[model samples]
Target chain A: GPKVLQIPSHQIIDMGQMVTLNCDPVSNHLYFYWYKQILGQQMEFLVNFYNGKVMEKSKLFKDQFSVERPDGSYFTLKIQPTALEDSAVYFCASSLGDKNTLYFGAGTRLSVL
Target chain B: GQQVKQSSPSLTVQEGGISILNCDYENDMFDYFAWYKKYPDNSPTLLISVRSNVDKREDGRLTVFLNKSGKHFSLHITASQPEDTAVYLCAAGARNNNAPRFGAGTKLSVKP
Candidate 1:
């Protein structure tokens, strides 16, 4: 079992503000992903990244959202000018390959007012 | 800590029949096990879970069977309904690994 740590288990921000969620994936994992889930809803896939580039992304991955893992450091998801609709739990996951099992963070709950 | 396998990609069963979903693991340290259910366009949600300490667990019409020796587990849904149709995912975790590994997924269709 590899731990995927998500910073600040809970985050509260005002609408139109900016926020950055950080994740420390498994050291040997190469494929990375982000999922969004609202309470009582299903876990929705946002985007997947590999080899320092985005492999695929869903429409839910709005233009305001961006992901990057710089120089082999923490993988990050940043949202600028956040909207109220963006409020949900964001989970970060990583695996050794795209087809491998994903190790997920406990999730960062974003509350935008 | 890594491999969680769901051999079946899809299943079709009659309404009110029993629906079985199976999963396997490659790690011996896997002490935690769980299942997730997902609908189209929705995120997967935790359904039922059990630890290695127990061999079976039941909730309403859902049951989880674990066989440590075989390194396998399964979810059995009785009285299956159309509403039960969704993608099912299996997850396994080891004592030393905090991250639980998940299987690809198995889509289930209950014909009414």
Candidate 2:
């Protein structure tokens, strides 16, 4: 079965530090997305990417956040000068197309203290 | 606006019993609805999906029923097992090319 893989199952960082989360989407997938789930809260969409550009982004996607699919190798989300409220489970998902079902990675847990 | 709401924050069922989870959405333009299961410390995995053109979709012990007019959907798990215990999230996509809006999720526990 096709699968999405995320690196660093867990990460802890200081409030002012920077962190980059990486995702390896399914080879044939054309659309990639990022979602965040705060403890005990619903999963919320962060952004969507396709054709090497951002398709849509939610208000939750802050200025400190950036996403890129450089060289078609890995899709990554980088947060600079992270804040305590940034702590959450970040999920990476991929789909064959915009409307197809998304397959998700195990998730990267980020904790900022 | 896109919003998906799930009912029954939590549920417990006997090993051989059935479990039902329901969801509702406010977006009338949504054309795709899906259910996902998530285990602790893991991302959600797609369980099943239904398009507005169809009312029911089933796979193995899991089934999804959609009511387009009411903007509601339900997932039914038959003969539940302990392994079926997990958080279930319902999501709806506005169009074929849009991102999905997910519900808070339902936590189900199948006891032995």
Candidate 3:
């Protein structure tokens, strides 16, 4: 089974600091997605990227958040100024296409103090 | 508004017993439903899925039942084990299938 790998399994940062989360999706996957899960809450969709452009984003994707896939490299999520509420486990997933099943990474646990 | 709702925040079952988790969707346009299992400190893993066109799908000890008429689905785990204890989430894809809406998740505990 294919797997998505997330870098820095755990990160602790001070509030107002910048943080970057990295994800390496399955080699052949075409659609990539980011999801956030707050403590004891459901997983919330953040954004989806394909063809080097954002396909869709949810309201939770705040203005400080940005995503990029530079030169076929890893997909990254950057928060300019992290907030306390931003502390959560961020998961990266990829699928062959809209109709294919998604594969998830182990997730990056971001803790903002 | 919540598009998907899972019943029972937590449940406990004895080993070798059956564990049933239920989920409901308010969006009639959602045609795809999936179940995922998540262990502490780990990302979710896809367990099973069902489309609106199907009534039931089974894989070994795991079974997924879909009731399109009621806009609901359920997952049954037979012969539960301690390893099966985890948070289970149910998600549904809208007609377009671009994003999936997830339920809050149900925590299952299988006692020895």
Candidate 4:
């Protein structure tokens, strides 16, 4: 099975600070996605990127959040001036196509104190 | 306003029995539905999926039944094993959108 790798399995940052989560998707996957999940809650969709552009985003994807996968390198999600509510486990996923099955990484837990 | 909803928070089943998980959705435009399984400290993995074009899909011990009229779907795991214990999430996606909505997930415990 193909695997997606997420860096920094755990991170603790002060509120109002910038934090970036990295993901290495499958080599041939074209569609990338980011999801957030708080403890004991459902996983919420954040955003999806494809072909160097954002294909779609949920309301939870605040203006402070941004995603990029420049030059086919590690896909990154950056949150600037993080808020207390931004603390959650962020999971990165990718698929060969929009309708294909998504492969997910273990996840990066970000705690904004 | 949850577009996809899983009412059951948790369920326990005896090993070798059937495990059924249910989900309902409010979106009519959703044409694709999938089930994902997750263990603690792990990300959700795709278990099974079905398109609106089909009412049911089966692979090995897993089966997904979709009722478009009712806007509902379910995952059935037959001959459940203890290792099958995990959180199951149901997700739905519309053809025109890239983001898929997910349910809260049902934590299943297969008792041996």
lDDT (0 to 1) per candidate: 0.85, 0.92, 0.90, 0.94
Q: What is candidate 1's lDDT per residue for B17-80, written digit by digit as tens?
A: 9999999999888888989887865545678888898999999999999999999999999999
Ranking by lDDT: 4, 2, 3, 1
- DockQ order of candidates, best first? 4, 2, 3, 1
Candidate 4 residue-pair clash tally:
0
Candidate 2 regions exceeding 4 Å error are none
Give the range of the ten consecutive residues with the poorest summed lDDT in model 1 chain A. Answer: A97-106
Best by lDDT: 4
Better of 1 and 4 by TM-score: 4
**Chain A TM-scores, one per candidate?**
0.98, 0.98, 0.98, 0.99
Provide the lDDT at A66 for model 1: 96
Native-contact fraction for each model? 0.00, 0.78, 0.68, 0.80
Ten residues in sequence with the least summed lDDT for candidate 3 chain A: A94-103
Instruction: Please tell me the TM-score of chain B in candidate 1 relative to the true structure's chain B.
Output: 0.96
Candidate 3 whole-model C-alpha lDDT, 0 to 1? 0.90
In the range A1-113, model 2's lDDT, one tens digit per residue, is 79899999899999999999999999999999999989988889999999999988889999999999999999999999799999999999999988787999988999999
- Residues B1-112, model 2: lDDT tens digits: 3389986799999999999999999988999999999898777888998888999999999899999989899999999999999999999987746798899999999999
Off by over 4 Å in 1: B1-112
lDDT of 3 by residue, A1-113 (tens): 89899999999999999999999999988889999989777788899898898888899999999999998889999998999999999989988877568889998999999
Find the number of clashing residue pairs for candidate 2. Answer: 0
* TM-score, structure 3 vs. true: 0.91
* Clash list (residue pairs), candidate 4: none
